[model samples]
Target: MVAKIITGKTIGGVIRYNEQKVKHGQAKLLQMGGFAVKNLTVNDKIQIFKQVQKLNKRTKTNTVHISLNFSPKDKVNEFTLQRIAEDYLKGIGFENQPYLLYQHFDAAHPHIHLVTTNITWEGKRIETHNLGKIKSEKTRREIEGRYQLVKAEEQRKQKVNLLQSLEKAAYGKRETKASISNIVQEVIRTYQFASLPELNAVLEQFNVCAYRGEKESDMFKKSGLVYSILDAAGNRVGVPVKASSIYSSPTLPRLEKMFFRNKEARKQHRETLRGQIQEVLKSCSSLDEFTSRLRPKGIKPVFRINEEGRLYGVTYIDNVNRCVFNGSALGKDLSANSLSARFSLNADLPYDLEREQEVKMGWHGNEPGKRTQLVESSPNSYQTEDPTPYELKQKKKKKRKKRIQ
Candidate 1:
């Protein structure tokens, strides 16, 4: 359920992008910013944007990528995604690019699409360093807070040690943000029951429910956002506790042992699955099968190719609580991972057969041998090989000679 909002000029072209054209543009963009850029190309133009060809497009629209990564490979909910898109102009400096042109959101991970003047509103330059990585990390942290995301792996050892030393206690998910806020804000605030059972006596006031197994997912989405104390501020005492301080109490103390115990087993399970995924690799008979093949093991496959071919990775579609390991993304991940489930994956299978398009559409050689068209900028940058600019130009001459024949 990612929603996208775009602002700027909307240009349309192939259902696909002209990577060759956008490559030249990205080279130029990086040259201007004086920062190295990687895995970039254009997205669908007018048709995909679904706007009028002429200036008919309006300003201030929405677009975003929703993400779900709840359980190992399940997304909790991405009703929408939010982002800010930026296109550099002839000149713009880092300091001046502060302002964003458009902000958008969708159910999954709402994001924004910006059509910025290459030249800043005032002529200057833009600056970006590891733009993708930085943006991804920042977004992840925010989501962790807003959605109560947890680092289940970290709790493995800590929970085990605590279990051995003392009689255990249980607590439910924090109830109200304001009450939690008051307690966390005051360092002196502390509460305790005589023992594990007593903790439940107090928890009774909060009405917390503990869940386990796949059932834990039953209440994952739509759970109210709760407040917690955060420690990043060096606020050892500033707030009593924060979301970062908490581990989701979806499992009660009695059952937590079973759900959170023995990571070695889970680790082995993941390893075995990874090996099995390698065996599952096979050229898909149809596009539908190809997309459907990604689910069972938890991979979300999006169709977008890069200069080398595709740049996507193991993704998730949480609503169904399935992994979206992209078959296309396998080679980059050492060709590991699997897909053993699903029937109907996506509506549009590979390219329409009537066109006789190659099944592996945008796969260019890793080295330069073929040329793709120029495209705009986007995050979906999977690529195949293509010809060197010099070679592509040389091939054009061959085409002319054949035409002369």
Candidate 2:
């Protein structure tokens, strides 16, 4: 089980979070300890916790909120979960504290949240320092072995090979600082990308982008990193949050070590990426067409284009394999220059019919009576039909009418 302990200055906010979950039908009051009532209601439970908290006036941040998340694969029941929770509290020196234990069904995993006060009957506070790394870690391992639960390290290994669910931004789902931190930690740990550009290739799939400050700035000189959320079209959605401010401090120095390590580690997966690119390129005629075919296969092709509309570089991030690769890493044939030349030869290869309808009509170059065709409009611009002789006469009549007016 994964244990997350959060300390709060007050108990009211902590109680409201779990109680609100129960009110919303997202969780249930599984078990309680050191309370008098046999069948306590939510209000009673809140009152009891608050009453215990009022006993100790010297301690601030006395609230200890812990969430123990068991693997979803485990078939443990409520009784087993309660026993585990009790053992964890005892192991962590919180057995005597007044706490509420809850079972949350909101996530895929089976988890329990325990909320308690650190202050005791004699107005003494419990030691919470190094609780996670020492006491909690030891208890977690003991319970995992005793209950035959899946090891956390093994689960992490399994996650490294699969794509993380990073669905498109929703209408009202607000992104928090914690959510971004979890995403950064997951991506940095799982995906194999050599540099920042390659890392962004993976992060962009999840509407996240990391930035280094302007080239001339002091932060840039210090190799600082900032993270921001991205919109559907890959634009920054809000102000970038600094990496240091995040919980794990995924700063540039840390990512630089990863960059060098990934440079060598990511090389092992290049063949797989190359095979997928080759399969798509052979079946699809143009870059536009190739991308449409690739998306369904969980492979996104990122093209780097120059100011003159020349394809300068290419990168492919395989969501299925959870790997990122620049085109040059694959081979000469898959490089941007080679693919650009290959695509230029087949500019009219069926015109990506499905894409043609979706592409917006727009003006291109400095040409009259001509406009760019939708989707794959390249090499030659399509011209509008010429005016008929009668229409020309009608145009002259209209011009004459305007002059008379």
> Each prediction's TM-score against the native?
0.20, 0.55
Per-residue accuracy of model 1 over 1-405 as CA lDDT, tens digit each? 121122223233221112222332311111112113333234423232332222222332222211122322223322322211221111112223222122211112222233322223333322333433454445444545555545434322221111121211112222233333223221111121112112222222222211111112222222212222222321111222333333222123322232223222233333444454444446565335655775554432433333443322222121121111223322333221212122222323232221112112111111222222222332322121232454665889899999999
In angstroms, the error of model 1 at 82 is: 5.4
Against the true structure, what is every candidate's RMSD? 26.5, 13.9
The whole-model lDDT of each prediction reads 0.27, 0.69
lDDT of 2 by residue, 325-382 (tens): 7676677777766776787732222222312221221211112223333344322221
- Runs of candidate 2 with Cα error greater than 4 angstroms are 1-164, 167-172, 175-179, 292-297, 345-405
Model 1 accuracy (lDDT, Cα): 0.27
lDDT of 1 at 113: 31
